[model samples]
Target: MTEEFLVAKDLRKRFGDVPAVDGVSFTIRRQEIFGLLGPNGAGKTTIIRMLSTTLEPDAGGIEIGGRSVAEDSVGVRALIGVCPQELALYPELSARDNLVFFGRMAGLGSRQAKEAAAENLELVGLLDRAKDAVRKFSGGMKRRVNLAAALMSRPHLLFLDEPTVGIDPQSRNHIFETILRLRSEGMSVLYTTHYMEEADRLCSRIGVIDHGRLISLGTPAELKSAIGPPDEVTLEQVFLNLTGRNLRD
Candidate 1:
């Protein structure tokens, strides 16, 4: 049986009387890509923050790699990496510089940071562009750099929050291939995105949340089978059926 790498149970968080997350429970198995699908304002970000050790939960328990988040935030930080939706690079710096900086932040020595930067830049297909200023790169290139920066920590679990938001198809595909490769190498991921097709193609299992509560949880096929024949039903249909068609904006 696959081991559970991350466990979250009855997670509840509230801000100024507004409940951002309530009674959520799930487990991510080792090396699994578990996707969390939710509408805007549905608390996906909140959950990610809590699990990543940035935000403490109002009520709940979180364990990553058998270490309690509340007890070992430092340990948890070492085991996970986060690539947020927004770009987190210094525009004026070279791609290599940005990666080395992040590597240092993750506690690597200068030599180690530079070495990891080179390896990760190559992994993201950006080794050839490593010396270029980030501000001069295309949106796709910047996105790839963002991913490489996150890997400087060599995290066992990666949190990808909308990692492919606005990149070109080639860059998007590169990110996809990189993620699959990581999974094959025994890395676990908690991915959150609004792109239904991405979740369909990548996630081994998915959890759909709305109004701060999880409404459904299943493999893509199982979720699709809920609304129609698995082969005939697209994930978009299942998502809209569960979360409705109202514009989140």
Candidate 2:
């Protein structure tokens, strides 16, 4: 059996009367790319935050590499990297500088941080732009740098939240290739995306969530098999069928 690298069991969280995440559970195996699919306000980000150790669950448990998130948050943090939906880079800093800073923040020495910055920037195809100010780069370029910054720590698992949103197609494909390369090299990824096609193409298995509950979990083919037309069906249709057509804020 494949080893489970991360596990979340009956995770729960709430804000006042509103439940942000309610009894969510899933396990990610080594080298697997798991997709978390949900509409806005579906508690995807909440779950990501809890797993990344930024937020604590009110109930339940998260274990990464057999360490409890609530008890060993620092250890969990060390094992995982995060590329948040929002840009976390310093716009005024050069790409290399930003990465170096993040690497240092991850506790690498000056020389080691510089080396990691160079290596990761190269990995994201941004090494040529190393000295360029991030503010002057395009949206896709900024996103690439953000991804590289996350890699400075050499994490075993990665959480990418809308990594391709608002980017040009070429840049999007670049990011996709980068992700595939990481998976090829045995990195586990927890990918969250609104693009059904992306989820279809990249994820080995997907978990669909609505109202903070995991509504469906299956391979893309399996999910489509249940709701898709006999002749053909898109992931979007399966998503709509499971979560409804109502708009979310």
Candidate 3:
């Protein structure tokens, strides 16, 4: 069996009177890509933040490679990389500079950070624009840099929250390819997105979260089978049936 790289048990979190995450539980195996599928206000981002150690869960346990985030947050942070839905970049800085800064924060030496930053930028096909400031780049270019920054530390576990949002088809495909390559190279990924097609294309298993609770969990085939068959039912139909068609604001 593949070793579990990430584990969450009865994870719970609340904001004010709203329960953002309630009793969520799952495990991601090494080299596997797991998708968290949900609509807006479904608590996807809340769960990502908790797993990345950016936000503490109000209750429950989270472990990354057997290290508890609550007990060893620093250790957990070092072991996981996160690319949030919001672009976290310094618009005034060059992509190289931005990556170097993030790498340094991850404990790389200044010279080593710059070297790694260049390599990562190249890996994401942004080497030509390495010296250009992010303010002058397009939305897709900025998103690429955002992902490169997260990979500076070469994290074992990666959390991507809607990484391909608002990008062109070419850029979106590039991001998808990058994610596939990472999993092939033995990195465990927890991806959160509302795109059913993306989930069907990449995830080994998907967990559907609705109103802060897990409503369903299974492989794409299994999920489609649960409703019927791939020819008879689509992932979007299954999602709608489970989550309902009501709009969430």
Q: Which 10 consecutive residues of model 1 have the lowest summed lDDT?
A: 1-10
Output the number of the lDDT-best candidate: 1
Task: Report lDDT per candidate.
Answer: 0.94, 0.93, 0.92
What digit string (tens of lDDT, one per residue) describes model 2 on residues 1-249? 339999999999998999999999999999999999999999999999999999889999999988899888988888899999999999999999999998988889999999999999998898999999999999999999999988999999999998999999999999999999999998999999999999999999999999999999998999999975524999999999999998888
Q: Clash pairs of candidate 1?
A: none
* Ranking of predictions according to lDDT: 1, 2, 3
List all candidate RMSDs to the true structure: 1.2, 1.3, 1.1
Candidate 2 clashes between residue pairs 3 or more apart in a chain or in different chains:
none
**Mind sharing the TM-score for model 3?**
0.98
Provide backbone clash counts, one per model. Answer: 0, 0, 0
Error of 3 at 1 (Å): 10
Which 10 consecutive residues of model 3 have the lowest summed lDDT? 1-10
lDDT of 1 by residue, 116-142 (tens): 999999999999999999999999999
Show where candidate 2 strays beyond 4 Å.
229-231
Candidate 1: regions farther than 4 A off: none
